[model samples]
Target chain A: MINRHKNLREKKGNFWEERLGLRAIINFLRQKKVPLSEHTIWLYTGSLILLFLAVQVITGIVLALYYKPTVAEAHASVRRIMTEIPLGWIIRSVHFWSATGMIATVFVHMISIWLLKSYRRPRELTWMTGVFLLIITLGFGFSGYLLPWDSLSLAATKVGTDIPRVIPLIGGWISKFLRGGEDVGADTLTRFYLFHICLLPLMIFLLIGFHIFLIQKLGISHPLKYEMRGIKVPEIPFWPDFVLREARVWLIALGVLITVAIFFPRSLGPQADLMAPTPAGIKPEWYFLFLFQTLKLFPSQIIFISGETLAILIILLFLGLFFFLPLIDNQPARKKGKIITAISVIIIIYAIAMTIWSLFE
Target chain B: MKFKYSCLSRRRFLSWLGGGWLATFVCSLIYPLFKAITPPYREPDEVVLLIKEVIELQPNSVKYFSWGIKPGILKRNDDGQLIAFVGVCTHLDCNVQYLPEKRKFFCACHEGWYDENGLNIAGPPPKPLRRLFVYEESDHLIIRREEKA
Candidate 1:
């Protein structure tokens, strides 16, 4: 019976191969290899991000079934989901945790790839696409934050959306456009809702698909040290070996996500009140704290220009330098690469310091 | 020669397929962005601008409030009529404030000024402040920007 089953499977495989070149595709995948190194731990961050995104998508879909986007119904629907729907709180909590996890892991993955010089040579497009993915992920966070329509989120959204009004030209229009007129009202809610769930997902799906295709085509980049030494390194096949290793990471990430979701379910704040003054100490999300702190350092005006505008532009320029690193330093040099690594380290340290200080402040 | 021809044709077929998919996806993505930027303009059910407690506000007092999505001002005139205008200055679009003592609206950004009736009174304001049509209920004021002629 086992021999007969094998024969049947062989026949089916042959049928697909004959029509669709299935065997060729499988062979290509089998031949793919990822280098084994101490840096393998960093490699896991990519898969960790993917795992969190999967969790986010699944839980987000489930939550959306019950979540309302209108200001009047949004808070109430969230409350009902937490208190009434079976396991809805866990689902929502998991989604929240997964979003934070995705952002953290994606940021780390980008920096790792940047430090590793993975954005070099044939992978320039890959680097640009990754930058875009990071932007979209932040967009996801910003848009999703207001879904609950809680007072804290509403105030944060108001301040967050208002930041763009400081830009030189078209600034006011940009803010008004984002809020769907003048303020965060029903129009703003619907816009953010559509952005978080629909437009962003569509963009991310396309970008991620292309990103993966580029990585698969280019293969992962060797560490700069190995390249500098011109040393031969060992590698493991992508399927069954590299893939199985990623599964282990996914399992660990899932465990932590579930543990957090179960132990500390997400909080629902009070309903939004437009008339009341914003509650004090209204800090933005952790990822944005660095920028928020930076903005605070600027004066109201800078030599006839809006100081906030100038500060934001400078920050944008700093980020743009990182985004275009591949093009900036193509044909990599050890000295330049080291400088970049040092800068990345400093940025990370500065970000952590700013986040903690903002919390205390 | 025949093999080369077949290879070219196969590659062309794949190109066509990929291009078709790309075009469809691009159109789908761009549509929503257009939708999002263009705010929906459904006619409001009742264009009432109830500022709550018309009598409580002393006459000649300017009450600043939101008229729907726009910042608005409602002043209880000495004659007991409530006059309303959009709070945005006609120049630079900076928010204007009412200096009731001066009986004028002021824009601090560039020194633009308007009279209590929303006519530009001084300082680089090329146009008058936009007037809003409003009616008074027993204790509230109603604004109808699109009030019929």
Candidate 2:
């Protein structure tokens, strides 16, 4: 019986091999090895992010099946999905939690890569691609937030999209393009819906593919200290060993996601009344709280320039520097790298403190 | 202490467990997609307000009514004739409030304004408020979508 089962499997495998030449790819996967170290756990976050992205894509498709992107029907449709559609609440909740999970993992992945100084030497492009991916993921979150057309989302989107208007030349145009007009209305809803579903997904897919290709081309980075000490790290094959470990991590992440989604399903706010006063103490999504707080810290005006414009310019400058971090810190074992690492730590702490402070306020 | 099961080794058991989870996961993904794609039947677009509801609307005054998912304004002109307009701003669809004293409609959002006849008058309103065809039946006032000429 076992022999028959094995023969059947081999026959099916051969049939596919004959048609599509998957052998070379399989062999490549078999040859790939992951360096196991004390920091190996951080490597799991990369795949965890991929897993959550898969979840987001699947659940988002399910949501788009029922979501109506219009001023009148958007809120009502979300309500219906929550209350009427079979198991739709679960799908929507999963999508929500998956987005949150994905963004969180991206932050972790980026931070770990930064702290480990893995973006040193030839891995600069990989780090840059990863940063771009993070930005695109945030864009996905921001765009998706407004799709529900609830009062909170409406208000938050109004504030969020207005941030870009602080730039000097194209700011107004950027805001206009984002809103599709002067205000967040039906056009904004349709535009954000298109962005969340189509443009961002397309960009992320291409970028993620390229990012993975680069990661493959230049294998995963080892810790700077490990390299400096010349400590040989043990390696395991990617085909079965690392893949199995990664699969286990994915299972745990999935379990947590499901539990959270099921327990604290997202609730729909009342439909947005465009003319009604903005809700008091309105807040953006948790991931944006730090930026939100920072924006709030600036007064209306500062010297000659508007506080907001200054804040936005400063943020943009930092972001530009962050993107080119690999070029900035050329030596991983030197004083410059230590300073950059200290700066990164300070930024993380500031972000966390700001997020907490914003939550309280 | 070393006894092994004849039907299920550790490898076979683990594979079975993984396969079971994989099957469950795939089904979970498929179930929501299947349930969501089958479109829900929606009610036909029709809203009729009873005449008595708006009968008390004084001349040169406006009363609010539900026009499907949107709001509508039923205005009684100084001539005591009834005209209805969709209470949504043309500039950027906000609920417009009628000012009986001013005999005009005001959109708080973007400060858009429309005249008593729903014509764009001031502020950022580029076009007039949408006018609905108001038909008086024996007992009801039916508001229908305006036909483009």
Candidate 3:
């Protein structure tokens, strides 16, 4: 049997030879196994989130083919997709929902890791990189919002772009660059499209590589408290163990996204009427509604300053605090403290409250 | 020495055989898994409409006809011949109107202009008005409008 198999391999030649080479890589991976059990499900969660991001990139590229970036052409192009292009609606819908999915998964991944205290010790850099990734993901959503160039999109863009305008001396300049001029125009759409499709994705790819490399290097973190039994924790290779679980989660996520896309394909309201009065009930995407509502909750003027400006300041300050959290909360012990728990509860309450406010407002 | 060599080679062969199966399984699963998650595309049918009777639509006369999801407009030219165009303008795609005094299909959006024949004459219009497939069907006007593909 051995002789016959060897002869068959010889007949197959280089293709079989390549397979032989992969054996060495597989052996290396096997030797570096970090213990994975059902308890450490967060690892699989992170992997699933990355998988969704990959899906987003692939669908985004396909949608870009039919999407136009010019202000004059943008809305018309979207209409063409609905009316003329083959399967154009499906392509656009996938791109739309996948973006929402990517952000949703990222948020879940972040909160799970934070709750698990997986960001402590060796994983501090991982946590920081994730924070950066979250900001970039939001940037992706914001820039992509204006591509449709309809009334709601335009209003949302105006409200969103204004958030960055509270950065003191640089606020006006940043808004100008973001809008590609004084207001949303041909240059604005083109700039946003380039950023959304090119710059942000490139950054995400590089950061994701680093993120994965760090995960492999550091190995999966065990649950906050776990004891090794006498028989030793049964270890499984990540390729099959963690990956198979991730595939199941991905399938479920895909099913939900498709159901939503088919039932509620992203809408295209009337072409943006600049001369007409701003439409009522204007709001941002669901994810950002919390912040939008928070901004609205403020008084017309806070200490003689515009409410919008003050709200912007508060958001920036919160972001600044998030970025420097590792440095600020550097404790030698891995145990959670009262301070961290209190802060976490406050954040949860604030997010929930703002979300409810947004719905009502 | 020969015995030792054979043992090492056997182990290597088994490792290679196992690795080959695993790689094939993973690669095959990934492609279909990705495809299953992707949204499927469906093409809509194309529609065309034609004019049958020249209703002496006076200059600047606006009449709405069911085209697709939206309505289309029919206006009489200064020559008093029935000239029909999609009410949706090519520029920014706002529904347009025939300003009888203006003698053109005037888009309220950015004030885009179109001539009697629906040729965009001014403003940011990149193309002429999309001409509907119009024809006479047994003395009645028949328009061919493409369905969503």
Candidate 4:
């Protein structure tokens, strides 16, 4: 009887082990923490991104239940949710505000690493993966903007899709593919919906997995001062130090988001009327406001090519430079230089100028 | 061992308590703020319309009139009896305009068509025209603005 009891206890232990997988992972993390590295900070950042992504996905799915894809019904359905469905406006507000907040957080996270010179040798792949993630984040915003099918969304989409039309050889084809037709209509909404909810999401998931994997493989980048110490600093455990800090940041973010959602829920405007002339002062989401305003500054025509074409060329050149930035600065500098500083300053000025122009002009 | 592990530092406990309180306070503040921004709900009310005395609604003619922010149209048929219908089309709720020459209420949205009696004649409308309660009062036509049964 005693022998039988011992076997039963062993079986119970195995069952418990399978059920507490997180505990096992946490134990492993605890064991792996090095003594002197700032692993805690990177872990916190990663955790916060994960938490925000969770919020985005959950709120997005809820909003999707009531969202209509057709232009005719889309605006009405959104309005219905605001007025009829219980807490629907709050859900939508959370999704919208969270999306904007996530983009801001990701940008800050990227710039912080860059300023800290953490994107150095042996971490180029990490930086590249991050850039890809940034692209996907922007993709999320662009596709999401059209779901409401408001007049502003419609006009912005028209201006946005035109950017690809300026590509030298395949610009027109790219624009056509993106718009799914010659003009913005049901087809455009369907295509954007698919990209936003399906294709880009899959790509983002894969890239995020790869990003985390690369980070783990390379280990957290040590502070600049620690690089010359000959001995690598040991990392702290992710649990109590990192996760706890992350929870605080997340709580703060949630507080701010809820406040914004409550005070300023997403706007609903007059339903989109295609036959009606486009309204004045139509602008894209704040993130794209700068680009929208940029397109407006160009003259109606540019050297026989349309003004839109010239604008597209300029944007493409800018994107090309952005993607190839690592290759441009071949020097092994630890801090900012004249060239880097100049580029950074120019970008800041451009962003500010476009924002101001969007508001005034 | 579990008891020892469960115990938190005083500093950590204080911070957690402070954070929790702050979050609750902010959440409470937000609830009222959301209520303040939402538009006040107004009950749909009955509208009394004067059919003949106020407007010239002729035979085979339709006249659009507003009833307390809700628009309704009065149409006089060949028999000279006035028939009233909500101006908003059943399809996507765009206001329909009476094309006097065409003798039909035409919705610009997707080219929806409704006849003289406001019946859905063409397009993707799933239902017929929504009729309002109409009665002649004091030599005038009045329409109750409640939703059609």
| Prediction RMSDs, each to the true structure | 19.6, 14.0, 12.7, 11.0
The candidate maximizing TM-score is 2
Give per-residue CA lDDT, model 2, range A66-107, as digits (tens): 899999899999988898888889989999999999999999
* Residue B98, candidate 2: alpha-carbon lDDT: 91
Which digits, one per residue and each the tens of the lDDT, describe model 3 over residues A121-170? 77888878889899899999999888888888888887777677777899
Tell me the whole-model lDDT of each prediction, alpha carbons only: 0.82, 0.90, 0.73, 0.75
Most accurate candidate by DockQ: 2
For candidate 4, what is the recovered fraction of reference interface contacts? 0.00
Worst 10 residues of 3 chain A by lDDT: A224-233
Best by lDDT: 2
Instruction: Compute fnat per model.
Output: 0.00, 0.54, 0.00, 0.00
Poorest stretch of ten by lDDT in candidate 1 chain A: A329-338
Sort candidate 2 into its docking category.
acceptable
Chain B TM-score of candidate number 4? 0.69
Model 1 per-residue lDDT tens digits across residues A222-275: 887887789867899887788888977886787788789889989998998878
Q: Is the docking of candidate 1 incorrect, acceptable, medium or high quality?
A: incorrect
- Scored by Cα lDDT, where does model 2 land? 0.90
Ranking by TM-score: 2, 1, 3, 4
The DockQ of each candidate is 0.01, 0.34, 0.04, 0.04
TM values, all candidates: 0.68, 0.75, 0.67, 0.67
Look at candidate 1 and give me any clashing residue pairs.
Answer: B49-B142
